[model samples]
Target: MAAANDLRRGMAIKYNGNAAIVLEVHHRTPGNLRAFVQAIIRYINTGKSADVRFGSTDKVELVDIERKQLEFSYKDHNGYHFMDPETYDTVTLQENLIGEGRDYLVENLSVQVLYAEGKPVQIEMPASVNLKVVESAEGLRGDTASNVTKPAKLETGKTI
Candidate 1:
């Protein structure tokens, strides 16, 4: 158990008998009122999010979370496939779990997968990825504007 005041983003906790991941946390002290902790958590089972409040001194049950580094293998009709570097085993994740991170996925890319209660919960990608621009319009002559932009398609089928 841990105090509500010690809560931090990305921490997992058991709330109302459900395992949830803390997405955001804020400590607030309203005028003439006791201080409280405000947090936004997403339930692992239902994938639903809720805003909760707890007294500053309240105890919260912490859940164990594990992170594993996996390398991207490929994506087919079955789903996205990843391989564990140490075990040489393949793990397939559904499309819903991949989310927008699919835009940055490439062959042999390393990513972090978060597991809660021995189940995959989230995928963490690097802050930036190097991708090849497969399609883009040619720039016009003297179009060196500082803020100029154009539509481009990445190798992973994401348009930016």
Candidate 2:
């Protein structure tokens, strides 16, 4: 069991019969009342999301989440595949489940895979990924002093 104050961003928790990730949290204080924690929760099962608030008097259970560092191997019609460096075990992560971070994925890049109840739930990439600029214009005018930039496509099919 854990208190509402224990909540944090990216911390996994249980809500309304499913797993949820803590997106944002804020504490509110009033004149008479003490304080409360307001949170934005995203449901992992159905992709339906919502916001929830937990008062100081409210107590909830804190789930233990385990993350492993693995390398992204490849992708296909099946899904994005990741391989464990130590065990050589491979797991497929669905595209839909990757949400908005799909464009940042690259081959053989290390990612943290979150597992709950022995089931793979989330793949976390670095805040910023280093990708080679694959489709940028040749050059504005040689490598001289140029103070302008233009649209470019990264090697991972993402626009930079």
Candidate 3:
């Protein structure tokens, strides 16, 4: 157990008998009222989010979390597959859990997957990824105007 005041973003905790990941936290104190902790948490199983408040001295049950570096293998109708580099074991994740991160996914890209109580809960993406530009229109000659932009299709099928 840990004090609510120690809560931080990305921490996993058991709230109301459900495992949730803390998305945000703020410590607020009114002029004359007791200080409290405000937090936004997302439930792991239902993918639902809720705002919760706790007193500064409140005790919160902290759940153990594990992170693993996995390499993206491929995606098919079976969902997204990843491989553990050390053990050579493949793990499949659902599309909803991946969310917008799918746009940046590329074969063999390394990413961090977080697990709480032995269940996968979140995916951590790298700050930047290099992708091949599969399609782009040729710029007009002498059109060297500043701030010029064009649509580009990446190898992952994402258009920018």
Candidate 4:
């Protein structure tokens, strides 16, 4: 257990009997009352978000989360599949859980998946990822100085 004041974004904690990841946190002190910590949390199971408040000194249950470095194998009708490097085991995750992270996934790309209670809950991506461009339009001759950009399709079928 830890104080609510210590909560930080990306930290998983048990809130209201359910496990949730802290998305945002704010410390506020009202002019007339005691200070409290306000946080925006996303529930892991349902993918729902909620705002919660806690006293500065309130105790919050911290959950132990496991993170694994897995490689992106492929996507199929079932879902996105990732392979454990060491065990060579594969796990398919639902589409909803992959969320926007799918935009950066490519074959053999390494990513960290967080698990709670032996269930995959969150995916942690690196600061940057290199993706192969499958399709791109020819650059305009004089557009270099104007910061022009063009649409591109990646090998994973994601357009940017």
Candidate 5:
């Protein structure tokens, strides 16, 4: 258990009977009123976000979360797969769980996965990834006047 004032971004807590991660937190004190903490939390199960307020002294249930670096193996009918390099074990995650990071996934790419109570909760992609262009279009002649850009397909089937 922890006080509401101690809540910080990326901290996992049990809220509303579900495991939620703190997305944002702000401590506010209104004129002639006591200080309170306002937070935005994202639920791990439903992938829904909510705004909640709590008194500064309120008690909150903190969850134990673990983060691991795993390598992207492949995706198939089961789901997106990642391998633990140390143990050579693979874990398959669903497409929804991968979220926007799927666009950046490539073979042997390193990614961080967050687990709560031994269950995977979230995936964190690196700040940036470099991918090889598999297909691209030829630039038209005299089309470089403005900041023009062309779409290119990466080896992972993502277009940019």
Candidate 6:
């Protein structure tokens, strides 16, 4: 059990009966009442997260999350693929879970994939990735005049 006041950044705890990380915590003290807690939480299991509040003395359970570094291999009809750099183990993640981050992911990019009880929980992509601009337009010498940016295609047949 953990005291509400003991919460810290990155600490995982039960929130609304779901595993969550303590993103932020706020303490509230009124004129004549006991202090309360308000926290922003990110759900651990499903990635569906929200903000919630609790009493200053509220007791909660903590959960530990394990992460592994995996190299992105490729994608096919079976979903996105990743391989553990250490054991050469492979895991596939859903596309919906990847979302807009997919646009920045590149082949062989290293990402941290989280798991709980041997079940894949989340895939954390790197802050940046390098991809070949497959269909970039001919760079006009005067194109640098403005701050405007144009869309470019990647070697993977994706456009940004």
On lDDT, who's better, 4 or 5?
A: 5
Going through the candidates in the order shown, the clash numbers are 0, 0, 0, 0, 0, 0
lDDT (Cα) of model 1: 0.92
Which TM-score value belongs to model 3? Answer: 0.79
Residue 4 local lDDT, model 1: 99
The best candidate in terms of TM-score: 1
The alpha-carbon deviation from the true structure for residue 58 of candidate 3, after best TM-score superposition, in angstroms, is 4.6
- How do the residues 1-160 of candidate 4 rate in per-residue lDDT, one tens digit apiece? 9999999977899998999888789999999999999999988888889999999989999999899999999998999999999999999998766768888888898889988768887788888998889899999887778788899999778888
Question: Which tens-of-lDDT digit does each residue in 61-156 have in candidate 6?
Answer: 877768888888988898899898889988888885465667777788898876654556566778777777878766667777778677888876
Give the per-residue lDDT of model 3 (tens digit) for 1-160: 9999999988999999999998889999999999999999989988899999999999999999999999999999999999999999999999866767999999999999999978787788899999999999888788887767889999999999
lDDT of each: 0.92, 0.81, 0.93, 0.89, 0.91, 0.77
Write down the TM-score of every candidate: 0.81, 0.77, 0.79, 0.81, 0.75, 0.64
Clashing pairs in 6: none
**Model 5, runs deviating above 4 Å:** 1-9, 22-59
lDDT digits (tens) for residues 1-160 of candidate 2: 7788888877788886788877778888988988999998777666566889899778877667899998988989999998999999998998855767789888888989887656666777788888888888766667567567788998888886
lDDT of 1 by residue, 1-160 (tens): 9999999987899999999988889999999999999999989999888999999999999999999999999999999999999999999988766767988999999999889988777788889999999999887889886767889999988999
Candidate 6 residue-wise lDDT at 117: 42
Order of quality (TM-score):
1, 4, 3, 2, 5, 6
Clash pairs for candidate 3 = none
* lDDT score for candidate 6 against the true structure: 0.77
- Compared with the true structure, model 1 gives a TM-score of 0.81
